[model samples]
Target: MSARLRPTSLPWSVYEHLAMVVGLVSLAVICLAWLPLALALRPVLRGDIGQRLGRLAIMRGFQLYLQVLRGLCACRFDIEAIDALRDQGPMVIAANHPSLLDAVLITSRLPNAVCVMKAEVMENPLFGAGARMAGYVRNDPPLHMVLECRSALRHGAQVLIFPESTRTPGYPANPVNPLSRTAAIIAARAGVPVQTLIVEFSSPYLGKGWPLHRAPRLPLHCRVRLGRRFDPPRDPRAFTTELEAHLRAELAGPKTS
Candidate 1:
């Protein structure tokens, strides 16, 4: 898709109300179908079958959401790294969080992406319902979450995480959350490299006061650029510092960031 040069604007309240309705309806549908589907087929499915089903459902749901956003609210996404994504393995996909739906956007585009979400999401009525079905790793303590992430990748799952921990309220150069050492720690223990994605969304409609129904007159643009992977140091503190410096470097030089 081509980049949208012109910027657009819409009332935040309208989008907010519309989003609430959509979310409620979507949640109801997910709950109604999910229970029956889980009971009827989980026992029948075996081995990679369950994984495949989970992957499909999650991807399909995410894609549908993107499509709806594009069609209804003028949101458009452009994903890069098509070539590198083909040669897949247990990858640690780490990214900066610019928007609330950044994780969902990544999931919609990547295959077999095992997401690391907060424990609260598992309890959230609307999101938890669908996320539980997708089998995302919970945001437990560092040790446990790391082990779970490693296991998922060892099983051919591509792991996606936001090292920034939370979305940036604005497009600031620095990350909002203190850079967590967890990502590097886990990668080093798993003996794997980390793939970096710098995600940016222009004309965001889903932020603090924004809504889903508010369509931007100008199209929204979001991009995920894949960066080279690197090995982590054995020492936890050193690994964390190196990863932080590397991420800062990637965000440096005005042309890219």
Candidate 2:
């Protein structure tokens, strides 16, 4: 019953220390690279090349950030079903928003991705300018945002969206509204399949109410599983239910338990 008795073995404290060192170090690196470009050049760039390069740079920067954070904390990640992302086309990349870093990870791994982020993230001093340069979407007028997502997909861009619309603080597992199906709608309209990702970290930093400075490091074990693609339902309600179900099932793996 004990972890030592089980096939897998590792000390709990080791995981914690690894998490702390990695998180802090990576956070520092992110501030150094992303903050500068986001603050300085992001405002000056425009058009496709600028946007594309910005997104790619920011995503890559964040990837390094997460990697160093996990390494320092002594946390590790194991990804499965990577082939699901191999086939390329305009895709609806939907995933559970567990941490602020989730989008960064997803974007870095996926090509031609335009994130569906909150309007505020576009205004935040830390993320706003870079997000705009990357041509990420804002959570604006419900119908209009959906339409814009449709347009982005039509233009041959893979659109990434957190169905929950915002970070899940209170009930991280459960969705907030469950009414909005913006991602699904866009997928259905474009006749593209939805690619679902379940991102789980052994212990996360930004999820819930933990303050940034006071946050404790837990082993930053991350499992990114890409689920089987499914067609968006014709009916809006059914589409939403199916999307949510896919995400939950992907994240609720017994192996994770």
lDDT of 1 at 77: 71
- Best of the candidates, lDDT: 2
Per-model CA lDDT versus the true structure: 0.66, 0.68
Q: How well is each residue in 1-257 modelled by candidate 1, as lDDT tens digits?
A: 22432232234545544644564466356555665675456566645667568666777677776676666555557764533664567778878776677777788776678788989876766556455555578878777898988887777877788887766554544434457877777787787778877666664445534555554333456766776676644776776676667666765644221
Residue-wise C-alpha lDDT for candidate 2, range 1-257, written one tens digit per residue: 35563323456555554555557666666755676776677657656777778777876776677667555654566653543574487888887776776776677675568888777767877667677777788878777777877887787778888887766664334533353677777787877888877777655467766566554445346667776677765776788887777666665554332
- Note the residue pairs that clash in candidate 1: 15-211, 15-212, 16-211
Once fitted onto the true fold, the runs of candidate 1 whose alpha carbons sit more than 4 angstroms away are: 1-40, 43-47, 173-176, 204-218, 252-257
Error of 2 at 38 (Å): 4.6
Best by TM-score: 2
